[model samples]
Target: MTDNPAPAVVEPIPKWHEFMVPVLRVLSDGKPRTRRDSLTATLDEAGMTEEQRAVMLSSGQPKAENRIGWAMSDLTRAIAVAKPERGSFVITDLGKDLLQKNPYAITQEILRNIPAYRDYEPQRQNVSKADPVDIAVEDSELDPTEQIERGIQLLRADLATDLLKRLQERHPDFFEEAVVKLLLTMGYGGAENRGRRIGGSGDGGVDGVIDQDALGLDQIYIQAKRYAPDITVGREAFQSFVGALAGRGATRGVFITTSRFSAGAIEYAKSIPTRIILINGKQLTELMIRHGVGVQIAKTYTVAEIDEDFFE
Candidate 1:
């Protein structure tokens, strides 16, 4: 006879109340403390492991830091917590007041104390309350493939927005380099000689010229724009750029901008034979982020596929 297989283990659910109960207890025992001190003490007193603490603090995944960070922002805005110095966080007077009460009351009581929270509480509460039920219902109703596709789209958009924000914050120059590199990656002509000594003044709107081949024979014109918010490329700008390309006897031109093109400009470019390809700011950011041009992933998630053969 075949031996019976071991039972499959089910992961336990993470309770926010369990996490905050200990956190509040730790704070109530002391005046004010840093996260490290408070967390360490709470874990020690509760006789929990670091992994268990992580779960309690962050819903049982390694993404605890990010979740806690977001929570800190909300708590800070509510005046329940305050960061007096860099890398140091402590409970505020309001936090202490809340800590004196039942741990289960923390979320609502804290929100009730803040005027801004009170004003936005209904909408925010609705979202938090509805999200789990909505997600459960959707998961049951939709095909798994459709859900996966939607998740991928959301992740891509979030990654693009994050990459753009980081570029604006840490490496502004790299953003310009990224636009050029993206153009080159798409088979534009300006890759030779480090994109120099090609187009001269009065060559129409061509700012850079890339040879179509290695023999320095045919060329394509390029116009790059490093634009900020509220700065959109217009039809007049596109017209001027096309005029320059035509002057150089080039039928193909790439107009790359870190900002979006106006509707008229897009329509005008399509109407011409200049073969103008426009890369708007949003698309550019998404491409850069996807290609890892100037961004790095701080964390990674590995999703696994089930092995159906094992069940059989």
Candidate 2:
């Protein structure tokens, strides 16, 4: 038999308006639905299976639920939609009107029509806009290398924050795993084995431990936690971890958690001789994505810099 080549699967491009369209339709139909109901029903009508919908909702891809939530927030503010009760949403008259009128709906059209949304549209547009005059003036005012570096930094910061928000909402355990992986990736320790059952004894606050080097000359302690919303790592926990590190004679320790550190914890960590690195849920997810620990880059953009020598 002749070998058959595998067919290329083209991923569907997610559109903000497309996702919102079904919700609007449901609401316009005079059927009030909860967010869960709306999401499930819309996905069903769109011919998406449960597994497909699950992947689409939490695939860690761009315009996933986190981005969708951002779009939903904007749409809600613009009077395009209304949340009659917590977790329940319906289309406003404006949304229904726009839905019927715009056959080819774009985010720009939605923003332009909504007074509350117009402010955000221009800011988003300016982020990727290229104007020769503006570029020339900006180049003259700032060093090109510095400008690019700063841009990358700002993008990284934003990505970190967005990843954090999403992690908190879904796969919180992954966030904790992410911290351990990030530390391992950064060469603070060797390989990471999370949630390993270590015989009858619990590891206290410590979840995993690794050597500072391959030879296993020194060991670093780790405390991994999967935390929920508004959870904060307190000073007492930090002190206990420090004590554990001291007992082991490890100068370095990592506190990895899917939660924010208390102000007192931050101050206490700084004052201690035990070198403690704190990775909050946000930073943990960001570092994991950046370092390619648990994420794969689906797209790559090669941003070119202008060659000044060409003018010479």
lDDT of 2 at 10: 45
Model 1, runs deviating above 4 Å:
1-152, 166-176, 187-204, 296-302, 305-312
Clashes of 2: 0
Model 1 alpha-carbon miss at residue 295, Å: 3.3
Candidate that would win on TM-score: 1
Model 2, 1-312: lDDT tens per residue?
A: 998998655456355455566556656776667866776566554455444444544446433344345445545645577666557777877887777876344354444555433322322223543322232244466676757664554345434444544555555445545555666677665454322212124665566666666666777667776675347899998899898777777898778776679999999999988898898766676667778775566546577878999987
Q: In model 1, which residue pairs have backbone atoms overlapping below 3 Å?
A: 189-210, 190-210, 204-244, 205-244
Q: Which stretches in model 2 have alpha-carbon errors above 4 Å?
A: 1-70, 73-177, 190-201, 302-312
lDDT score at residue 41, model 2, on the 0-100 scale: 64
User: Per-residue lDDT tens digits of candidate 1, residues 1-312?
Assistant: 999998655345333323454555666644667766755665564455455444443335443333334444445445466555544556766767766665554554445555533322222123453332333244566576767655555455445544443444444344545555655665565446333223345535556666767775777667766664347899999899888777767788678765578999999988887787887757676666666666677656576899999988
RMSD of each: 11.3, 13.3
Each model's lDDT: 0.57, 0.60
Residue 246, candidate 1: alpha-carbon lDDT: 73
